[model samples]
Target: MKRYLLAGLMAVATSAIAAPPQPLASADVKALVAPPAKGIKVLALWSLDCAYCEENLTALRAYQRQHPDVELIYVATDPAYQRDALEARLKRAGVDDVTSRAYADATPDRLNFMIDPSWGGETPRTLVIHADGSRKAVSGALTPARVADLL
Candidate 1:
């Protein structure tokens, strides 16, 4: 009886593992751990392989046009999982070497460190902070209305 129950549990776990990850959206790719951006900070944690992330790439470009001084950032959660794809995605997103970028684990403790502990390493997270030290965070994807609230 125990053996049968164990087998049943294992089957359920296996199916769960096979399930696809949630799609990342612009809101999801928006921020993870968000350190105060000094001026206006917008943190986005995303990947190229994620279709949901692609949706927000367009908004990011649009944001750049309007908020030139808003410090936009991207943190590639695990580059090894999507290195080439990430490169292509960013390039297509018009995000380049000159653009603000970081690796979640590689970041030192001095700068954006506080955000790491806060986010608990979740991807597709977002945080927006104003120069006056006001801040907001959204898990999953944030909408234009949400972004507007922060501004």
Candidate 2:
């Protein structure tokens, strides 16, 4: 009986873990920037090597909580094989609830261009798309005022 109980508990715990992020190819980048039908949407692009990504993600998560009408999408510039590490880092930053994606294309430069032509491949970049089809892109770690202004 004790062994059976432990096995069941382990199974439940494993099942509760969040799934790995989906692949975000160049073809799918447009969908990330599409205007929401009614509410605002924020797309955050970050990478594992970026020093400020965690801080930005934590702040964004808090902002989303305060403004529930805003939708948050998280994309890791890392490859799909690193999904485990990406998910773990995002979980630590308290951004596990939103849709998450990872770069899966052979040509990351092309994918980056699709995400933003003028971006210059920077980490901790944010793109805020409004329902009216206006977009604002910001690079570097986001400050409270900066995030507010972008939204």
Query: Which regions in candidate 2 have their CA more than 4 angstroms from the true location?
Result: 1-17
Q: Number of the top candidate by TM-score?
A: 2
Report the alpha-carbon TM-score of model 1 versus the true structure: 0.56
Per-residue lDDT of model 1, residues 1-151, tens digit only: 9999999999887655332222222333334333454667776666544555544545654665687787766655543344555656666665543243444333333223355346654446666767676677665655566555554
What TM-score would you give candidate 2 relative to the actual structure?
0.85
Pairs that collide in candidate 1 are 24-52, 27-141, 27-142, 28-124, 28-141, 30-44, 31-43, 31-125, 31-126
What lDDT is obtained when candidate 2 is compared to the true structure? 0.86
User: Candidate 2, which ten residues in sequence have the lowest lDDT sum?
Assistant: 12-21
Off by over 4 Å in 1: 1-38, 80-83, 104-116
The TM-scores of all predictions, comma-separated, are 0.56, 0.85
